[model samples]
Target: MSNRLLTYNPETEGAEGGLLIMGAPTRAAQPQPSTELEELELGSAFLEATSTSELASVVNRILRHGALLAGKPIASQVVQHLGARLNRAGQSVRTLLAPPAGRSDTAPSEAMERITGAELEGLSDEDKEFETARAFVRFAMEAGRLAARAPSTQPPAAVATAAARVAARRHAPGLDFVQLVPGFRARRAIRRQSFA
Candidate 1:
């Protein structure tokens, strides 16, 4: 067996273990930080993911960290990551982003300005993807923005647009599983609303 640390998952014993990405690689174990600064830096590793594709893993990692930190630091990371994308998003995506409320992040608010000020009658599929992803980011941001959870209470990057034949279940109450990561899933998923 792999030397990677195994987090026990009781699949087929219940209906919830299915949320894990099937066949996800086991994460290599790393040393616990020796310093407070190191620990703080290591804490945000989830946000360092490079693409929108890794959204689910990044989001889930964020959630895991929330358990550790007792807050939604991951949500803020999602907003900043997605916000950067939105800032650089094509004119179409920018046009679709609805303005955020006064307390919202800048990118959402920036997108919102364009959305309300523009006619925005018709946009291409890519634009809609941007819009949808933006909305998901906004929804997930509630973890940090308000310190609360939404039904879709989650975060991550590269929210998929394709449909995949996924078997999903509710997140178990105390533990989490990481099956096929959002990046891999986004490339292969076969459904409308895929998440990790």
Candidate 2:
């Protein structure tokens, strides 16, 4: 009986053995792309942007990609809000580059110039690039703050209820006994006999 139990059945074992021998060679798992590498590539593309419109487009693409990566509706909202800021910043850059018909070129308003520290008119290419990068960094900081403030998906009431359930479970060690025995009471009744 032991020999019969130990003996491998050809009908069942043959197929598995054959499959193991004939199986395709396994490949090594590939590593996932790093976010830092992606950020570097995006930064390079942003720096290469020639015009304000191009810059804004690059920024928009970055924000959209971020929103997709986050995989949340609030992330989409952050993208929309930041996208508007990027557009406004681009418009400001354009204004700084070429003052409007009525506005004097020498005295560009503080609000318009605030986005970019230096005047775009006479700065070197490197300086202009630095200013643009600085503006983007500022925008990114604001985006970080906004994302941090995103509302929780669960309602406050639901969160409180979940916390209360956890607390009850933790505090009541013998609750299972009271629940399992219908007639069992947590407190025992005391009976007193008076001396005659």
Candidate 3:
């Protein structure tokens, strides 16, 4: 009997003589254009996903079907495409299936003690890890097609804080800094009014 689960020998006449059926093979119903995890053909049919969910669904389906192409070139292309989709979805491929850094093997815990030592901090380690993991999954699901629009909000507090710093720098110094808006623009408008 042939070791392959799915045999395709044309000469193998009967089920017994030719392609002897062994075990249930994880084969798709005729290898159509892989909707998601395909041969990584950019201009191929995979690029036609109309929505984010559609793209994600396709990739997930491909993964489920064990759609692995032979050769490094094909594999690399597939990885790149997957990465791109995940990035578009605001996720990273590396962390897609990885549990949080300190998570246990079996049962996932809500214990934030190990992730972060600072109890007073509003942002917990668990929260950060969960957010990161979510982003990775979303990215993978969407087939690495990053969105063109601005992100809904900064996924990480650090990014938001950095943006705040940038805004602060762009504007003039505030009144003793606390609870005061910058006066630079206001001062300019006042000068213009005087000239008018």
lDDT scores of the candidates, listed in order: 0.32, 0.40, 0.31
- What does candidate 2's lDDT look like per residue over 1-196, in tens digits? 6854454434323433321111221123222322655655665666667677787777666555543443433344445544554455444444454566897645543322344434566666555544544444334433332232234443322222222222222222222122222122311210111111
Q: In model 2, which range of ten residues has the least summed lDDT?
A: 187-196
Choose the strongest candidate by TM-score. Answer: 2
lDDT of 1 by residue, 121-167 (tens): 36654444344343333222322222212112333332211001111
Best-to-worst order by TM-score is 2, 1, 3
- Provide the RMSD of all predictions against the true structure, rounded to 1 decimal: 16.5, 26.0, 24.0
Better-scoring candidate (lDDT), 1 or 2: 2
lDDT of 1: 0.32
The local lDDT score (0 to 100) that residue 183 gets in candidate 1 is: 62
Cα lDDT tens digits, model 3, 1-196, are 6555343343222444432111212122332333532333321222444455655555554333332221112133344433333324322222222457785733222222222222313545445444333322322322211111102232222222222222222221110122223268754653554345
